[model samples]
Structures are given as C-alpha cells and as structure tokens.
Target chain A: MGKKITIEPVTRVEGHGKVTIHLDNDNNFERSRLHIVEFRGFEKFIQGRPYWEAPVTVQRLCGICPVSHHLAAAKAMDVIVGAGTGDGLTPTGEKMRRLMHYGQVFQSHVLHFFHLASPDLLFGIDGDPAIRNVIGIAKMHKDLAVQAVMMRKYGQEIIKVTAGKKIHGTGAIPGGINKHLSLKEKMSLLDGKDPMNADKMIEWSLGGLEFFKNFHKANKDLIDNFAAFPSKHLSLVRKDGALDLYHGVIRAIDADGKKILNDVDSQDYLEHIAEEVKSWSYMKFPYLRKYGPKDGWYRVGPLSRMNTAEFIPSPLAQKEFEIFKAYTNGKPNHSSMHYHWARLIEILHCAEMMKDLLNDPDLMEGELVTKGTKSYEGVGLLEAPRGTLFHHYRINKDDQITMANLIVSTTNNNMPMNLAVESATKQFISGQDKITEGMLNAVEVSIRAYDPCLSCATHAIGKLPLQVKLYDSKNNLIDKRTKD
Target chain B: MEKKQKILFYGYGNIGRQDDGVGVVFSEQLSKWVEDNNLQNIDFDSNYQLNIEDAENIKNYDIVFFVDASTKESVNNFDISSIEPNSDVSFTMHAVSPGFILNICSEIGEHQPKSFLVQIKGYEWEFQQPLTAKTENNLQKTLIFFKKYLKKLLIEKKIEEIDLKSLLKIKND
Candidate 1:
C-alpha cells in the first residue's frame, strides 16, 4: 500500500474543498474523498432577530442565487406567520415570481453549460485548462457565447422588472412585491425587442443540443459505467404533486423510483434527517433514519429534487424525464456525466414557462402587493438550480429576525459529491499520467454540474482561487495543487 | 407602445456585514413610501448594476438616482452643500459606479424632466445589526430629503416624458 494523493482546495464551487484519492502500488482499488472545509454560523447568528427581515437579510448569501435564498427566506417567514395565501401577492405577482425564477434557471443553466461545464466537454476532458473557459468557449463558439450572455441578461431583466433587481431584488417583500413591470416589460419577458430572437435562441440551442448529442453518443460506454451509485432525491412539489419551485409539499424518493415520503413538512426536516460531522472538515453529511450514524451521504439539489418529484411541470421537462425514466429506471445516479442533460432540460422548461408567464393577463394587474404585518418562526424550502435549499428563521415580537438556519443545496449533497470524486479516482490507474488539464477539468466540470455556488453554501468566503493544503499519509506533501 | 423609464436608486453591501447595506436599507424604506403614497410613477429595477449596459433600459428613464452611505474620504460627506453630478465616467466592464455613471450621463444629455440623488452619512459599516445610532438617526433626515426630492420630480410631472419616443438612448456611447 502506498500513501494517498491529495488535490487541495477544489476550485469552481462555492467555498473551500479538497479531494483525496488513495493509491496502491499493485494497481489495486483504493478509497477517495471530497471534503468541504468551511462553514458559517448565519443560522446561529440570526437566532433572535425579527422574522420578516430575515428574507431581505439572508439574501446576502450568494449573488449568483440570491433569489433562491430570497424564496427560501420568504417561505420561512410564510411558515412563521402562517400566511401562505399568497399574502399580498397579486395573481400577477405569483406569475411574475415564477418567471423570475425561471429566468434565474436559464441564466444559471446557461452559465453552467458554457462558462462552467463546456471546457471539459468540448476540450476532450484532458484538454488545456487555461483555454477551456468562457474565453475559450467564446473563441470556439462565438454565437453560443453571445447567446449565453444575452440569455443571462434577459433573465436578469426579468428579475429587475419583477423582483426589483437582477441579483439583489431588494423590493420583493414577503406579503407582496413592491414593484410592477410596465406593459412593455410584459411583452419583452416573452420575447425581447426582436420577437424572433426567442425562436432564434431556441433554434441555436437545438444545435447546441445536437452538438452535445454527438459527445454523449461517442462517450456512451465511459459515461454509462462511471460514478454510478445509490442516492436519493428530494425537492419541493406543487400542492398538486408536480415538480415546482414554489408552493409545494416536500417529497423524498429512493434510487429505484420508490417513494420515500410524498408529503414531508419543512418543520420536520431535522426529525426526518440528521447531519453528522467529520473532524476533518466543517461539512456535515446528512443521513436518513435507516442509516445509522448521521453520515455525509444524504443528498439534496436539482437531481435529488427531480428524483423526489413525481413528475416534471414543464412539457419539455416532462418529455426529458420520460427519457430519463427509461435510462436509470427513474434515478440519475452518476457524476457530471448526465447532470448536463438534466440541466438543459430544465433550461428548456424555463424558456417555455417564461412565455406562459408573460402571456398571463393577470401579470398586468396593478394591485400586486398584500397589506399585513407578520412576525413568527418558519421554514422555507425550494429547489435551487443546484438542489434543495432550506431557510429556517426565528423572529422577535418586533418582527426582526433573531435566529436563522440555512441548509444550502450544496451543503446537503457535499458528502455524496465526494463519493463521486472517490469513484472517479479508481479509474486513474496509470499513476504516471500527469495531472493533466483534462483530469482537473473533468473534476471541475463535475462540480459545476452541481452548478455549485459556495457563496450560497457558506454565506462567506468572497473572491475566488481559494487554496487548501494536501498532506500524504506520512504527513509529507506528495502533490500540492495538482490532480483530484 | 411607449417605454417606461426606470426610477432606480442603486444600493449595495451585505446588511449582515454591518454598515455595508446601509444604502440598501434606505432604498427599502423609500420604496415602501413609494408603495404607501401610491407613487405609481416610480419602479424599483434589478440589484447592483455592474456595467451601464446591464441597465441599458435606464436611458429610457427621465431620471436615475444611485443611493448609498457616504463618508467622503476624498472630500467630506459634509461637503454635500456644493455636490453636483459629474459626466466623465465611462462604464467599467463589470460595474458602472453610481457617482461615475451619474456624472457621465449628465454630461452628454440635457436634463430630462428631472433627475436627483440623495445620500446618507454612515457611521459604522462593519457587520452589525439594525443601523447604528447615527445611521438610524440620519435615516429619518434622509427620508425627508428623499420625499422632497421625489416631490420635486413629481411636481415637474417629469414622468410624462417617458411616453415620448425618439428620446430613448439605449447606449450611452
């Protein structure tokens, strides 16, 4: 047996991370690990503040997904005050919020695909990391690059008109929104100034999908067998039991499509699942009741959310799900390989739903806010682009937030994602193979597949290229910042 | 077929991180008033406007304000008696600094129906709870000023021009 190799501080995700892969001289199988190294006490910090303020305050978690945090924060407030009747939200408000989130979905998914995930897929996994980026994608596919920015801009525009800002929507109040879109905006959200632009985008995306199809088709064998494992899914379901971002009952489903619980309440999350900590890092592994010792195995996020829901809400998403159902018998238990598919399907759904949202006559209504005051404790749950996000808050009588607890999607799936890295380690038998751009890019791509946002996960650690140290079994540095 | 101009006030910072979000807090309070008095003339746009391009639609607006806490190290927040908008700011790649954008916008164009800015002096910007005594105290004063500022625009019926076309400038360049 030989000492283990470490890839310190995995890049691309929200916060600090490290990957460890065990090696044996005999070319035998060994273990691997992915660990998240930092955690903040925002949950503990917000313990006694007013409840209504929690949404606005906690939204500082991550700029990339502030709305995700905002929705969760609002939901937490909703439960505390027990005012779920869409409060002061106008019919237009509800539809508008949905469209806003869909816009985020498109922005995030496009970013994930082109800026985050494309380098590995396009550059042959073992390609050059220096060029496999937004810049590289721009060079290789200029049209796609322009579309990504345009799409992200449009998404941000929707956020601006509805919630009040593209990233920091300061006016989206709990009872109701404080802003309204003009009739001009109502039309633009469906299709920008050039109505045919949407169609052009769709046609362009189909071509992109066709491009991805060739990659998947060629790597069918490698993808089918890589990082397949047992995992569960969890997400918010519509009251009608369909996949939804807001207003839903929680669902948990097993790997084999078996329903674990279809009507789980947010308050009972702790009772149903427990997280255990490893001394090596701050990340916790959420575990099931049947699983002894709260291990870092319980998963959450888009894949898990999809698994939990009985059906997809968008027709395009539903069609994709039908194909997914046929693939892994209803569970997509893998690494970065297929997350791209799940993500693209979601992007299509968002585009279609955005049109539906813009077409609603109620969206033009003026009375888009509710009139009331609320101060109570509650939990909010929603499916962030990455996974399941939870926001729990405790408020004082003054309606200020006193305590806050957040279960970010990345945190929930931290442990399982590590297991994935471990599984990938077994494939690199030729220890002589250099820590190629391909290998590191593959790992980063897989992490982005989660569309991982550490800022949301950690609520701290601003700026990027965060570094961590790696030590061999003998405590000697074999590799510093190289292979995963 | 008329475009509605934005009535935006840029505010930034993480509230939990102390005084970082003072600007945002003020914006929230002002927005509430806009809601309360049935101020249909104003609308809140998206969060931080990184580049001017991010808010291309702002060109359609008759007025735009960027609100934030100020303690002018370069001059002095107390120097506001002579403060005026500048116009040389070229939008940065990532963000259009509020003060900078205002200066640049004012330079190339004649005054629209109206435009104004309001600032509050912040004492402590460290991560803290509820505005500090100074910030809290200053909020009321700022609010009063904002109300008057808004009234000035309203009195001018400046929003009326938003319905006018051939006036929109999608790109500042």
Candidate 2:
C-alpha cells in the first residue's frame, strides 16, 4: 500500500506548522503539503477600533515580529494622515524610524541565522539530535554562541531605546515619531563600554560573515545545492535601486533576473499582487497579479531582497554583496540555503547603518511630528527581515477602521516553503521504506531556510508539540513518534 | 552589618493575551509594591517573553525569581519550584524555558544565580480580554504570598539558605 508521512509542529522554526508527504505503494514520493493549522482573525478584531490605534493594536497579532507589524501599521496610517507615504516625516522622525528598523532586521536576522539556522549548518542534518541546538553550539563553539547572544542583546537594546519599551512600544506614530533619541542614549549606544558599542557590533558582524563564508567554502555542495529551485523574487528597493528595508518602491524579478514587476508605488500594490486562498492551509499564498495563482508565486525575504536590489548602500556590506552576486554571476540565487548568506550580509549592513545613524545629529534633534490633511485609505509596504510585508487600511468618517488587511512576510513565502518541502522530500525521502528522524529533519531544514514565522503568518496559536505519524494508503496508522 | 544580597524578579508573558499576562502583571504589581515599601536590594523586569540575553541579566543578581502563568493541571492557585540548568533544545526561540535560560547563564556567566519558578495558575488566554475572575484571584494570592515570603527572606535568612520545600508547603492554595 502507498504511505503517508506527517511531521507535526515542524521543529526549530517559529510557530507551529505541519508537513505531510505522500508516496505510492513502492514508497516513491508522490506529493507534499505544509498545513498552517491556526487561523488569524486580527483584521476582523480591529474593524471597530479607532484608526489611530491600528499600529499598537496590530502588534497584538504576533510577539515574534510585532515591530514589523507596528511599523507597517504606522506607515499605513502615515498615508492615512497624508504623511506622503514614507518621506514626509521630519529628519528626526524618519531617521529614528530607520534606526528602529535596522535594529529589528539586525536582531531578527541574527536570531534566524545563529539560533535557528546555524545548527543545521554546524552539525549535518544527521548530527546527534541531542547536540543539534544553540545549547549544543554553546558547548562546542563558546565564542560564536556568546557573540550570537550579545548581538541579539545589542539589537534589542536598540529597539528598547527607539521604541520606548520592550513590549507594545508606541514610538512610531502616524505622521512622525513621538520622541527623539537623547544625546545620552546616542552616546551610550555609539560609544558604550566594551563590546556593547556600535564599533564592536560592526566588528562582530564581519566575523559572522567570515564564519559563514568559511563554512560555505568547506561545504559548498550542501550550501549551494540543498533545495535549490527557480522562482521569481520580490522586495522594496530605494529609488536608486539600493537595498532599503524601511521604505521604497515594490520590485520583483523573474528566475532569470528579468523585471516582471517594475518599480512601482507601494500604494498600488493591490493592482500588482493578489493573495489566493487554499482549502488546505489557513495562510494565503500571495502572487503577482499578472501571473495569476498558478505561476505568479515568487520568493521573498533576505534572498529575494538580495536579488531585487541593485546594490547595498553601506560600504562593508556592499563589498560582501558583490561577492555574493558574483558567485552567481549577477543572477538571482535560487538556493534556499543561500538565505543564510544573504541574511548575514544584511546583518553587516544593519550594523554599518546603525553606526552612521548613531553619529547623525538629527537623531537627537528636530521636529518630532508633522500634521497634514487626512485621507481615509492607505497602504504601507516594507522589507521585513523575512521578506516584504504589506499593511493596508481604510477608515470611516469617524476615524474608525472599516477595513484592514495584512499580508505578512511568511504568508508571502507560503508557496516557496511548500515547494521547498517538496524538493527536500524528493531528495531525501523518495523511495525510502521507512521514515527516519534525519529524513524528517531534511524536510524541516528546507523550510527553516526562509525562517518563516508561522505565528505572524497564521496570527494564531495552538497546542504546538512535535510529532510524526506514518500511515498506509488505507489510512491505517503504521508508526508514530513524538518529542517534547 | 552584612551586605544585602541583590534579588531580581523577572516575569515574562504576552500582556495582550488575557490571563497569559499574569506573569508580566505580577512583576508590574511587585515593582510598585517594592517602590512603595522602600524595599532595598530588589529589582523587577518584565517582557513579552524570555530570550537568550536574559542569561546576562540574571548573572548580576544573587537570587532570581522567574514568574510565569501556568496551565498545567497539577499547579494549584500557584506553585513555586526550584530551577536547575537545562540545555534541552526547544523547537523554536519564540520563547525559551526558565531552566534553559539558567543553563545558558551557567555556560557563559561567572556564577549562576539561585533560581526558582513562581507559576501562577491561569485560566483564560483570549486576545485583548481581561484576566478572568478566577485567575485574578489566584494572582492576588500569589502576589500576597510573594510579598510576605520576600520580606521573610530579607529579614530572617539568607536567600540561598531558604528551604525550597518550605516554599512548596506554603502555597497560597
């Protein structure tokens, strides 16, 4: 009989997800799907609320990337308040927000690469499960472990400084920010004691790149070929085509590096992209409107951002970006494992940006807010650490939000993740008579490449425990395994 | 007079999620009480959840209390248990266990703080809802017990010397 294998609460990625693989009686792989079990009702929940509360209210959606939601909502409201999309803010306003964003991307990517992705790279997919985690990394590579923890701390410190608190930060408001960076705060972050300062962060970021490059050089086959596939890429880029995580025009390119969607105003995202609902998953798959559901699917996040941008604005990261692009001969990289390389490069860029922002005098002085004529509808788009994020809203005359839609980064990468699972299954589990832990891990490693935050995608939670079940074509259970 | 040992009460949970906020609320309430009572050698911090960097935060203190909400059936109104270093890897970094944080501290810091988990039983976890009546009552009981127990630890004995069993016997329930 044919067999079906299910891996529940796929391990080491944010939030809960399940992978199901089907095979013929001969144990040859047939197909696979990644099911998102939770349902997110944040849009309906925010319908009756005042529009001004959207930024803070939306944060209740996900703890993993609340800042992304916070800023995205704020940007949408910026348009609602006629703040000219993203550029109308005061020097202090825009700079502070950028600082906060770089901090978020810096910390988020660091966590993904070091805490989540490094284990799979350091210990092969078949390494002892007992020692295949950050804890294991700490036991063996103490220095790297310490650096990851410290780098996370530094990014969080930046968040705390800019957002005004650890949780439910209200720093970014419509029209502009509420406060400016204090001189003391600037000095503390810019020239803090050993290891906490921006200089040290830049140094460590370079070291991180070196570490990944060394690993890549030694394990080129695994790094370059694992789950490699072709797909279109999308992200927001600066007017001049530099990588801009904060604000820019939406751009997407094909698998062969041709612009399918030219640089366009984010306000018209609906005209360019659409989300398709699938019966199997709660999350929606987003695709380019022109290509339709069948072929419009595109990749997002760090690797996509690398492919879409023409260059890195910062000096150090720009150098690394050239090497990354040249490796593929300036073509878009389709290898899922290369996401780590792209993420590490962004980390270095963020560090350099932070150093420059810290030295800028405007962060400490200038107008804090701007007022303008109001509008009822707005759309906000930004490149989140994982990928491109969209926040759209329409409010009534009473300033109550009548409609709200959020297409989170994870949701945008839905199709890609499913494809990755399918690819890994073909490579590792095809023709296997029995499912092993290593085989299951191979499937997970592919999804982990995108660092999908299912919490943000589903915007919901459930009983998340790890388990795998095997069943015969008759739907009779054959084997089962679970882990806490 | 001997120098007073530094103590930290770190609570973590998502405040937006009704009863799930109990841990953060506990810390916030305790922070006010500490200020009002002019308490010394005590500090409080709260966040949506605990992360790896908390290992660095706890190393400076002599006693660490990790407050959290629990859904386990065995937990009564509230429960206090000792925490030992655990390096078992979790499926995600969205949040890590207190024991895991302690383990990281032991690995990197000079000395691990004496740590315990104060688990307040919570009932509801709906979004944007207030704490259910039953959970609020449990929280109050846990808070009252902690206030008294902390005073006793300060005035009567060294925190490291306090018996963990005594805490289990004195559950607010």
Task: Find the candidate with the highest DockQ and give its number.
Answer: 2
Instruction: Report the CAPRI category for model 1.
Output: incorrect
| lDDT by residue for model 1 (A394-428), tens | 66676767666677888777776776675566554
Mark the 10 consecutive residues where model 2 chain A has the least summed lDDT: A456-465
The per-candidate TM-score of the B chain, in the order shown, comes to 0.63, 0.91
Q: For each candidate, what's the DockQ? A: 0.09, 0.70
Kindly list the per-residue Cα lDDT of model 1 for residues B48-117, writing each as its tens digit. 3233233333445655655556655642331122124433222111223554344323322223323434
In model 1, the Cα lDDT at residue B134 comes to 71
Q: Candidate 2: lDDT of A34?
A: 98
RMSD of each: 8.9, 2.0
Model 2 agreement with the true structure over A317-356: per-residue lDDT tens digits: 9999999999999999999999999999999999999999
How close is every model to the real structure, measured as TM-score?
A: 0.73, 0.97
Misplaced by over 4 Å in model 2 are: B1-5, B169-173
Give candidate 2's root-mean-square deviation (CA, Å): 2.0
Candidate lDDT scores, in order, read: 0.60, 0.90
Fnat per model, in the order given? 0.14, 0.63
Interface RMSD of each: 10.4, 1.1
